[model samples]
Target: MAQNAHGGSRPGVQPVALAAAGILLLVGVLGFVPGITTDYAAMRFAGRHSEAMLLGLFQVSVLLNILHLSSGLVGLALARRIAGARAFLAVGGALYLGLWLYGFFIHRGSVANFIPVNDADTWLHLAIGFGMLACGLLISGQVGTGGRLDTPIDRP
Candidate 1:
């Protein structure tokens, strides 16, 4: 097997993790853009009062964007190895699930919603959480040596 820059086998790299990381990084960066993130001038450091919305859908703040960027960075760093990538997805997915549930208890436009999630964000979190978890559990070893999905084409 060919080794990558991270000293891991090229096939060990997880595509799902990379895609997740890329998405997060893109979203994070987009949050800072004025047009992409509406009400850019109203974005708060970390609070529900922030009026900024990414793609005019999901509410965003400086802190939330930072969190996304950080998560994406972690995913990228971990994607070099199969085990590390799976751990990242599993743990990150759980955290997103927790965030999703947390959004339920938070009242709209209340200080308690420091994470500043709206209904759109809440449902999106559910989808994202489930997706990440499924990818972690079911897709974990697909890219690694003799992975569960791997079958020798030369075999009779």
Candidate 2:
């Protein structure tokens, strides 16, 4: 098995976690940028009143950006271990799925829509949930007992 810089024998899960973390970090940072996030001045700390759109697509606020940044940081920290990476993916996926449902069911202008999620954000959340869940489950097979990398089974 190939060893990663962290000395982990399983390289698959770590890379996935790292990539996801990097993307989250980038999106979070872009939300604060003027051009990247349109109507930057209109961004609120939280709630439906925020008019800021990240990449002119998904709605965002200071709270949402902070969530993304924190999630990214957590992902980066968890990527050091296979179990931690798997947990991050699984738990993160579930959280996104829950958020998607909340956005889908909640009225857009209602106070319950505290995240102020739009249609695009809801759909993106759905995709991210499935993608993360799939990655976590698929990669888990490569993890052996005691959290070590499992050798591929030989075929006749």
TM-score of 1: 0.84
What tens digits encode model 2's per-residue C-alpha lDDT throughout 13-98?
A: 77898888888888889999999999999999999999999999999999989988988899999988888888888898888888
Clashing pairs in 1: none
- Residue-level lDDT tens digits of model 1 in 48-77: 889999999999999989988999999999
Error of 2 at 76 (Å): 0.4
Provide the lDDT at 22 for model 2.
Answer: 87
lDDT of the structure predicted as candidate 2: 0.85
Candidate 1 lDDT score at position 72: 95
In model 1, which runs have C-alpha deviations exceeding 4 angstroms? Answer: 1-13, 142-144, 147-156
RMSD of every candidate to native, in Å, equals 6.5, 5.3
